[model samples]
Target: MAKARLMVVEDEAITAEDIRSSLEGMGYDVVAVAATGEEALRIAEKLKPDLVLMDIVLKGGHSGIATAGELRRRFSVPAVYLTAYADPATLAQAKLAEPLGFLTKPFNEADLRASVEMALYKAGAEAERQELIRKLQEALDKVKVLSGLIPICASCKQVRNDKGFWQSVENYITEHSEADFTHGICPACAKKLYPEYFDQLYGKGSGGTPE
Candidate 1:
């Protein structure tokens, strides 16, 4: 498996470096470190890290909660909030951002590792669930298309779709499904359409092998 990429958003330079060093020591790739919410958003847009370690309080126009919410809404990136204030009011505001985990100040390396691992696992599972749902929806759509009673012209071999427009069989199927077509002429069609080239094309009495 690939290493999980991480971003750290902290206003304190020493604390941010400590977090970066700890995360890197734990085998995660610390892609970028931001000192403010604005920098976090800019870096998140460009790096698209797997997860972010966001400080709940920042010296900027956007708070960590607001930044995390923006990240989730725009880039689908999850955050693990780090803060010294774990009061009821702070927790209430933090919940609005829907973080993956919360770590109080002075957390140990073991706690950090556990939170990061669990968050990454949940994110991966959610991504897989979404992919499965998309595939199932596509399969259901294909079944609906093929199960319907299609109107086809017997002479022209054209199909009439739900929009009441006549289209070639290839065109209709291609539009409705993931199937594609490559042109080919069967022996019967070849004989009727191009008699002069039929014998040459089929290798005449040479058993379908050119002389």
Candidate 2:
């Protein structure tokens, strides 16, 4: 499997460097380090990193939650929030972003590794689901295209097969295609083709037989 690309968002220089070093040691690719939410958004859009390590409190116009929400809306990127303060009020706000995981400050290498692994797993599952849905939509789109633009002879009412040969519409329809046909005669055709039978059946000009 390919290594997961990560973006670290932290305002503090020491903390950001530590996280980057630990991520690299864990076999992850640290694409970029951002000090502000605005900068993170810009880099994340360009890099399309697999996961974002977000700092809940950053020096920027947007908060971590707001940035994660925007990224999710724009690119469907998954975020993992980090904060030293795990107070309920702060966590309540962080939960709004629907982060994959949360890591408190002063975390060891093991904690970072576990959090990053879970985030990558969650992101991978979501990516697979979206890809599946896209493929299904593509299949449906192809079906719709085949359903339209069918070439047929309007006058003879014969369907033109893929080989450009015009065959009886009934036989053409009954080919390997999914459609099934039941043979029937309409009132107009019955009257024109078998007028005597029509008269006998409907009492139309029955008094005068075919002379």
Each candidate's number of clashing pairs is 0, 0
Superposed on all Cα atoms, model 1 deviates from the true structure by an RMSD in Å of 6.6
Q: Superpose all Cα atoms of candidate 2 onto the true structure and report the RMSD in Å to 1 decimal.
A: 11.2
Per-residue lDDT for 1-211 in model 1, tens only?
8999999999999999999999999999999999999999999999999999999999989999999999999999999999999999999999998999999999999999999999999899988999999999988876634556889999998999889999998889988877778888788777788989988778767665332
Quote the positional error of residue 26 for candidate 2 in Å: 1.0
Query: What does the lDDT read for residue 87 in candidate 2?
Result: 95
Pick out the ten consecutive residues of candidate 1 with the lowest summed lDDT.
202-211
What shift in Å separates residue 196 of candidate 2 from its native position after superposition?
18
How well is each residue in 18-85 modelled by candidate 2, as lDDT tens digits? Answer: 99999999899999999999999999889998889999998969988899888887878889999988
Give candidate 2 regions above 4 Å deviation: 137-211
